[model samples]
Target: MTHVSGKRLSVALAVAAVLATACTGGGAAPKDAAGGYSAQPKQTGTPKDGGTATVALTPGLSPNYIYPYPPAAANGTVVARGLLWRSLYRPSGEGDQIADAELSLAEPPAYSPDRKTVTIKMKDYKWSNGSPVTADDVVFSMALLKAALAESPANWSFYTPGQFPDGVTAEAAVPDTLTLRLETAYNPSYLLSMLTLLYVMPSAEWNIARTGGPHLDYKQPKHAKAIYKYLTKESESQSTFASNPLWKVVNGPYLLKSFDSTTGSFSLTPNPAYSGPGESRLDQVDFKAFTSAAAVLNQFKAGNLTVGTLDSSFVSQIAALKAKGYNVYGAPAPARLDSLVINFKNTVNNFDKIITQRYARQALQRLIDQQGYITSRGVYNGAGSPNYSTAGHGSPYPPAFGDRPPYPYDPAAAEKLLTDNGWKVTPNGSTTCERPGTGPGQCGAGIPRGQTISFTLASANAPAFVGARDVAFASAAKKLGIEVKIVTKSLNYMYANYGNTYAPATKNEWAMQDYGPLYLAAGYPSSNTVLNTEGSFNLGSYQNAAIDKLINASTFGSDGKSLSAEVSSLAEDLPVLFLPTPHTLVVWKNTLSGPQSSFNALISFLYTPELWYFHDASGARP
Candidate 1:
């Protein structure tokens, strides 16, 4: 983890950058201006690099894959991206996680230059099959992420399709490079994020035409969106992407050699012929897995933790590690934010899902107390501030920071909003909806005057979520006039089929749900992925055009636009709110220093393993 530097220049620069984000619509960062570091990285680092750096992280598994292609926190994907894959473009250490941020891909043509198109040249690289990595691969991947069902069938950040308000079309404009044509001015980093954000299927591995395989053209409108589904869903699962020549079609420094599916452990070694910037410095990287985080510290003490994330409880141990002359690092978190996400597109009968009411759900923003929550958890280095509402809009940009007004805490206002909307609060505060006095047929006078709503909730087995957030909200709702019953189950079952009835998936069990999206980055629950009404990441399905428009405008301005001024001001009103910023302290030997690089900020909890180098990190570069 990067240590908190009090250098006035760096702090001033940091303030100016985040202030640019806060005032992006033109607001200023917090009063201190120098305290712009985000309190917690909601996500972890996937920043590009190699070497084994064991650390403690929470929710360390993916949906089920070796790559972040499907995005499971605990899965092999995060690790895989770090050592094996590359994004079209990379972020400049701003924003938190995959949604709503800048990019590292080929920059768009400068408008002043009057250039309508930008051509990206690929390095002289090839798939593991030895096929040259070309513009088509990028085009293919971009098209896949853009297709309408990108989220449902393919990659995790599905709403990116709409990101191109004017839209962009990629083609093999050049033999060795791709030519991207955007209708309006766009950020290269945003588009590059797709290539950087997702695990790219090898044209060779997927048996693509360019790989001496199939002649399939994903460019066809009909086949574009489904291309993502093909590589991810159609192919058989691999035991090791490195060992299998078929799956080894990548361009990174390391390759997978062995894996243990049952234990989720895997190993990697240098790829003799990788085409990226770094050279392998270690003999090999061994990834060990455990079901509980508590065991991570003990393992690290025994020299088993290749990388480490400090849990609040292990703060003393971390100090001990530092005192013992080990490399102890407190890296500055990159792209991370934690959120209590809800999927509103959920089925009416989907009891496993939570949050059906729009205003009621938005009301959650005010009800949460972030400071109190973070205090309760207690595992941070105290360098970052609460993103509170959105990430990067303040401390990340410039000018001593710019942001919206504060989101106030008002339980009474929250209850009143629910009450004025035909809800009747029982003495105990369990609310029941009064039949609509007038409006749609079902909610109109046609229905009974008032009715009570009672249901059970289904939750994934994540301790922080199920044990803390969900339970607390359930109790709080009782005060607002609703009965919420809690049910717990394995994370796999809860994530994929919680919305389905218990009789079939779980069989004969019925319940409502109140679970959040597993955020590796500490993110706000109001971006395209989490809140866009038509966007894929809007899992909770809570739709409000006003909020959506505000979010859209905010994200556009925040990403690389001049619109920060407006968005920062709007966010002050509040969108989605978590009472506390979740944190996990990381302790390493004092031998660590410089930038804690990694695949990206998705692994911020571990403080970016790739960047971990001895304090005298000068000669270690490849």
Candidate 2:
């Protein structure tokens, strides 16, 4: 979970073109500026490489583990594993949408007619230590991942029951090919999507035996457990990252050079043995941590940093930064969304009755002035739009769902819906259920007479913007005869109370939750993990047999029609109140050129630093 940078503020509307010119080097303007921006400058001459690019890292945001699988901290996943690791398929193109999968460590997979088996052809790549990255490595990595999942189910939430490395059997068919035979028929597209994020590890480094033997057999529960325990200890050795022999066998584009725990800073040098597209153009890259956005902006102002992001609070200062020849761009944050998730399982105070009511949920959605919320919150210059579908607006599947508005902001409509639903409204205050029944147009089953339409709404404590929005939501709800009491909690605490797998609703404690942007994994847009009855992220425990069917169909649904149908169904269900997609503000020096400045999924952004480069000898704009 990531925090909103700061108070939301809109960028100047007039500077859109300037920002485009600076970030894209006068290229065609982005179709949706808020969705994402490019830092790739249009060049007039040949690229000159060899310089250091300094970046500002958010303070206190450090990766606890550098490995990708078995889940590490978000920061660590984004900065450490994201940069140091390479997956079989890479996320490409702009926005959070699952762009075309770029071949990385493997070629396109070959699937059996039944779609139960897949054959992957590995690329002829080499690890930093000069060892060939072959099918054995891929198979071994899968075994380790499977072992890790079995040992720590909490970390691998994406793996469904009896799936990959569990239900599927893996074998090295050839020196360069690995075959996976699934025990059950599954969606090939979804399987491919999942593979795009898998970080293949070096088998030699990770398959060690803890008990005086050869490499531990991942197939054996005892050996797998021992290997998992050993890796866990290595992963937590934050102070020994640079010296860890196990981490030194990376196959990605950069090698860790040094780390300073005191400053939360690290530096990377291009991996000389890296065999991938867009070889490093810079000699080294330095990531420096800053306590606040102000400090980052100050460093940029002092010309001490080459690239960093500006919080919404700093959107107003873009003009000044551009005046100083810095390039600023608005990119859509990858998979990030702010939403009001209702707890359907909550039985405390009979809040479940009101929350479970479709009309009540629709009324609440309508009461929200999405446009006004974006404006006052001050981010992206109104680049935000009302999101109605479960998938984000930038998600590839939303367009297939077609443009549909289920509930427009109509306070009168909201009020009437409540009144018509048997909720009695006092002239200047909250409402009470006067007609509670199991029939249509009534506050569904279990609602008692005289029950007030009141519940607690909680937001994260940081990112003043979310709290501000919470207050605004409460104010609007109150005006329409709904009582919404706002409370603040730390992000961790909020998630503990409302996260998937574990939620306060188990004790019937929470009603509504508001927090930072929730990012979907790259390559596929499926809310199954967040919406399905058995979904790991199903915080509210919202269950619908019909919705479940749609989600299941979408998983392997072959055509655009199936995906469209699923998204369309979700848009009407109003499972969660979708909020605006916040603009990702990028601030960078004009000299840097490459894909690093362009919009890719957030996960890809942190991992592909090799694509960044200096345009000239002096690292100055040509």
Top-TM-score structure, candidate number: 2
Please list the C-alpha lDDT of all candidates, in the order they appear.
Answer: 0.44, 0.63
Which regions of candidate 2 deviate over 4 angstroms? Answer: 1-40, 43-45, 58-60, 70-79, 93-103, 209-213, 333-336, 377-381, 399-401, 462-464, 503-509, 596-606, 617-622
Looking at model 1, residue 332 earns an lDDT score of: 27
User: Candidate 1 on 1-622: residue-level lDDT in tens?
Assistant: 1111100000011123433334322222222111222232222322324345443434445213543354222222344553555455433343433322222223322222333466666557655555666677777666655553434321343343455422667768675766667665443333333333433445435534222545566777556544445554422365544454544666555677776666656676767776544445454666666665567766766765645554443444644654454443333233233445443443333322224444555555656544444334332323223544344332332212333335445778877765666667674654656745554322223224555544455665654433565666566667666666678766555544432211124322434344433332222223444445555444344466776665565444334432233234325433344433333334444433334334234334322233343332443412
> Could you tell me the C-alpha RMSD of candidate 2 in Å?
6.4
Model 2 poorest 10 in a row by lDDT: 5-14
lDDT agreement of model 2 with the native: 0.63
